[model samples]
Target: MVNLQVCSFNMVGILFLLSLILPTISGDCTCDANTEEKHNSAALHYKLGAIASILLSSVAGVCLPMLGKKIPALRPENDFFFVIKALAAGVILATGFIHILPDSFADLTSPCLNQNPWGNFPFSGFFAMVSAIATLMVDAYATGYYTRLHFNKQANAGELEGGANENDGHVHVHTHAVHGHAHGAVIPTESMTLPELTRHRIIAQVLELGIVFHSVIIGIDMGASQSVSTIRPLVAALSFHQFFEGIGLGGCISQAKFETKSAAIMATFFSLTTPLGAVIGIGISSTYNENSPTSLIVEGTFNGLASGILIYMALVDLLAADFMNPRLQNNFKLQLWVNAALLLGAGCMSLLAKWA
Candidate 1:
């Protein structure tokens, strides 16, 4: 966890540094003939409305699975939940590969960059590769650290003599029961222990951290824009963006099964980030220049980092976990259906990148 946090913070710092360098590296152009006073007015109004839609969609998406806990079909172990998670994983994967990476390439490769470095090399691919490698390091380190922590907790619990062994540590003992005429073992009491809950909660929180970074950047970009022609279509695209992203986030939050207060806090945070970004954009509109060289570098670098984080989380944490689970592995038909769902979600999100 410490390593992961360090790597993530480093990425954030690199992005911040890049933002600072942009204005110095790039020169501004005269306003386009199409950028009229009337357009600015329309853009402002549309921005305010867009902020509202993003906030609402984010809330609905994140909260849906949390509330669905009451539904038997939507419970974590249920087949329906499995399919939903697979679908969410696909959405996240597409957001990273199709949406964020392409946007980064566009910004980094813009004619605005100096001909020597920006024009000559593929910084987009380089950044993406660095981010991916960094993510792998964090993921490996964090998992090992957490697993050790679990072992330590179990050791501490074992030291206590008959002191609520189940509650005292992260390890839970399972008893396999045999029924008549059954070839394999059949045990019914498969309750999730508190330690398992802790792991899931940790995963959810880390995932949210990654999602929020990109969310705020997207919101800031939307808010700082002055083009209604650009902002108008984005309003609809972003609404769905948040909605699909929310579904991905919501699935993790649901699995964590945080207490009501924690759940509400997480949901609210996800919902407010984009709108908060817009509000910030409105406040700083006078100073913020989206097309400025400085802005592009900053935004592009951050988007690169975010793309890496989301892709890693989606593929490693979300997709691999479910796809490799014994439940999916043992059931061929269910696995086939999940693969289809994954494709469906990825396809839908990829299609949206056309307009967004």
Candidate 2:
């Protein structure tokens, strides 16, 4: 009798330890450990499918803007182009605010975390504040570096000019006059010179970094999720998500005016990231725990950082740069329409969070 009691106690102890390792109820329900394992296997396949779908959609979305060079309607100088870019920016802004940040909050505040440090304070706000500051620093540094480089280049050019075009030469005279005219334009115009081109390049590079950060994280999350029912909806939602994100990035790339090869490479990189991330996640899913302490910290930090960068880019680089231009400000009706378009874009993206 005593031996039987000891055996029963040992079984209970083992069960308790198992519960601590993975909190699960022993049942034939859908969410049981065994069911989850099976679902995770199916989810892996579905995630791959989602990755392919999103990659294709991203390619299509980005290619549309690049190929629009053939259409005068999609020209950079057109009013419609401005509206489209603004809408894209709005989507990115909403993505940072609505999607990623909220997910970070949910993960960081999950019941799985220990109550001592995790439950003691507002970690999300603190992390977000740090990220915002870090983004501002990066923006300031990049802009300053480029500005200094431009000044040095101009100084060197002036030195070279002293030996030849001591007076206003043919190219110099034309350029000087055109620079004046460009300044007089209603837009917040800059001398359309090498410096301007350099600035655009820097902006595109940084924007790409910001976007890829979030894209990979989302892809990994989807891949790691062990639920086929959940993964199926994400497959479609993420396709649309990547498509719109591609449009936003594509518009920025268009304005940057990179060389053909460089532009194509950038677009391809964006298109491939989410899918590549899904593949990576699949390979590491056994070791990658979304709810693990390390994962929660890493994901939350990245989410905060990505959110800050996207928000800053959308507000300062995209919206402010255009909205503050004399043309946009002076045209009341166009401004109204653009504002409506912005709101609509943000609304649509935020709504996607319901499923994605």
Candidate 3:
């Protein structure tokens, strides 16, 4: 509880500082008045098309892993499942490094912002670093808290059993020894423990938060733009972007083993965030200015934070955890295949950055 409170306080402080600096550092930056005044009926049509295409792609991508239970080849126990997860992790990693990070840098370092503060400082890198550290703190504390809770429950159960079996204490002890051995033998091949499952659930939720932050920003920008040519290509690129990202998130959600209702809620939430942002953008398009100092600061800060969370998650939670697993470590052939898949996923996402 103390740690959590400290983390919360730190976040509040950081946000407060950003709010103070953003307005004062407006610099020489001004929105492109010429672009904002332009209107294209064709762009409106493309925006609508983008909404439908992105929504469907997101739904399909996320639902694919949830359906894995019905297909033996896609089940979590299958070797191929690891390969798919690796690909997803790679995509996420590339998105953080290649796509979001650069955007944040561009936003915070724009010439329109004041040179004394915004130009003098690498706020983008600073925010990204701070956010990454914050994510690590959350991940560590949450895992430790859950693990401690699980063990405490087990200890309480043992106490109850001890009180009930005074007469058969020795026999119970002997039986427990054998039981423990049996449980230990199956640990390597069996599904995740309760604590491990809880950790995965936390990871999936946090990962979604990071992804949604960037998705909404991108969607809004796409919606607000008046160029049919720009919206047309972005519609396809972002569709593919959301699809692959959904697959990555879906794999984690599937492994978390959420109930049907919970899974549906999460999946629906992920699928709708982008489209919802676009809709909101459409409503505000006439007045919204992406290049405004306020817009740049808000979007840039959030993007930096999201990039950090994603980079940490992809590198530490996803890649390191899987690569270091005994099963992967012991099998050279599987490791090679997984590496290839990782590269392929990263390459594909990087290519999408060209347009998206």
Candidate 1's C-alpha runs over 4 A off are: 1-38, 160-199
Query: How many Å off is the CA of 266 in candidate 1?
Result: 2.4
lDDT of 3 at 328: 92
TM-score of 2: 0.79
RMSD of each: 7.5, 13.6, 6.3
**lDDT (Cα, tens digit) per residue for candidate 1, span 34-151:** 2544366888999999998998898878877776757777677888778877887888899889988888888777766667777788777777778777766765665556656655
Write the number of the candidate with greater TM-score, choosing between 1 and 3: 3
Clashes of each: 2, 0, 3
Query: What TM-score, over all chains together, does every model reach?
Result: 0.79, 0.79, 0.83
Best by TM-score: 3
Superposition error at 96 for model 1 (Å): 0.9
Candidate 2 ranges beyond 4 A from true positions: 1-41, 165-196
Query: Looking at model 2, which ten-residue stretch has the lowest summed lDDT?
Result: 23-32
Model 3 residue 356 distance off true place after TM-score fit, in angstroms: 2.0
Clashing pairs in 1: 22-294, 23-294
Output the worst ten-in-a-row residue range by lDDT, candidate 1: 175-184
Q: Give the Å error, residue 13, model 1.
A: 10
- Tell me the whole-model lDDT of each prediction, alpha carbons only: 0.70, 0.69, 0.76
- Per-residue CA lDDT of model 3 for 40-101, tens digit only, reads 68888999999999999999988887889797777776788889889988889999999999
Model 1 CA lDDT for position 87: 82
